[model samples]
Target: MWQKVIIPFSVSFILIGCSEPEPLVEPSTVYQCAALTLTATVTDTGLDIQLPDQSYALVETISASGARYRDDDFAIEFWSKGNEATLIINGEPFPLCIEEGTLPTSFSARGNEPFWLASLTGQTLTMREPGSEQELTVEAPRLVEDEPIMTWSIAAEDGLNLMILDQYCQDSMSGQSYPYTAYLGREGEKEAGCAGDPRQLLEGVTWQLAQTASEQAPTIQFIPESNVAGFAGCNRYRGTYQLTGEGLQFNPLAATKMLCDETAMAVEDEWFRQLTEVQSFRLDAAGELDLVLADGNVIQLQRKN
Candidate 1:
């Protein structure tokens, strides 16, 4: 006889590199040490061991009740009796011939069981008399309530300073480009496009540039969020970005698979990657943000919602 430990969900834990991650509420009711019986059955391309359709990720069949099975890399005790076994599964079947030789043994901890071996699927199991017409039929294990769970979660975005900018430039040859886009540190909903179609992120919220290169002026269309999401000139890019006191850097930046035979998009990618080092952001009378890179190259970002 054994007792199960109930871990309260209220327990606080310190997470490294994460600000504040939410916790899950433990179930009000928990299962006892009562062993359950389950059958593992094989399907076309998946393992139907029990629980839910997508429950077992790497098994050939699902199992229920008694024993369990998993791939290698587990701490549970495993055994393979030529894939054959006795059907003495409590009140279930008895003396069964499982595909013993081809099947392997595996297990994992779930529910109250710390390390239970698996007896499901591919085992050489047989029964005395399944029915009057048949001697024995191959059976799979059924997934039970005592199964394990594997999940993932994302971290919070708190106490972090961010700048949102959006800007596009057009060459005399009609070529379009986006020099800069960032989160400037504000949460407002308003705008002013006094100097032509200035970029707009929030409704009525516009950012103008105080300084310009003259040789190349950028156009803006204020939308929401930052410039990483939408079109960067004729090209489109979507990925993750990071900004520090020293500068900004983007990674795994990808774009649509289209005809970029022109140099605008190419220049846009190269220039953006090269300008990994940023100094600061400046605004103009028209409500726009300018990007100051390490090499002294500045690119004005326009908001294009």
Candidate 2:
């Protein structure tokens, strides 16, 4: 015969705990990756990116920790910290080092990442995936003269590419044309004005002669009223100018009838001759203006800032 035994409260609790165990529950965690919608131009050599309101050559720095884009059933992500960056295509990761103050040409040195067969032709961009037969293409937006808009294009993957375009559209409420990208469908801040106002970029800025043959460097000023004025080392001159697209033309310049040293006068004469041969213009990365002449001569001008 078994004898009935009494257990303490602690023993009874231990027995209950041994009879059944509680199920474990795991916490759900979510990882957030920053997504960026940038206008990408895929070219034969590489890619070009810019803000909707800025020039293709000039792109504003994005503050996001990372940017992601998806196309052709594939996704690409970029993580940027300072000048160093990492790009993720699908699931594979590649390291990239970005150059400051300018646009990048390639994905660091790792642009050949088994994907993105890219090419560009005119305003069309074409791209194709490696090991796949299908391709994707995107075309750039069109522009009209005096429409306050500029455009650039990129082609991805050997005739398969994407075109990115920008337009200056005024907000109905503000009555101001903000930089807008139709490809991304978003408007950015004043940085969109990074392309700068065409008038301000052309007017009232002083350009000092750079690397000229003259003993005294000449200078030129393009005033806002379309008047051009500058000193030709020995004499001050005034004229009218017209800017059509990238073409720059100066009307006949009238100079003060002042005679100076023989050498100085000779230099002035050459300066005036070079000025009359101007055809087009180019702006370098250092903000220097190159007034290209018909004879392939460049009269470089350093902006006074």
Residue 219 accuracy (lDDT) in model 1: 32
Model 2 over residues 218-267: C-alpha lDDT tens digits?
88877645677888989999989876534677899999999888877887
lDDT of 1 by residue, 1-305 (tens): 79998987786889769567676533221111011122344444432332212233223224443334443333221121334332222232222223311111321101111211111123222211123221222233322222232111111132212211223222122121222221211134221111101121111222223334332222332222233443433455565544332334445556675554355555555544643554544444564455666677766665433
Cα shift from native, residue 261, model 2 (Å): 1.3
| Model 2 alpha-carbon drift over 4 Å, by segment | 1-198, 213-215
- Against the true structure, what is each candidate's TM-score? 0.25, 0.38
Q: Could you give the C-alpha RMSD of every candidate to the true structure, in order shown?
A: 30.0, 20.9
Q: What is the lDDT of residue 273 in candidate 1?
A: 63
Residue 261 in candidate 1, Cα distance off native in Å: 4.0
Whole-model Cα lDDT of every candidate shown, in order: 0.31, 0.48
- The number of the candidate with the highest lDDT is 2
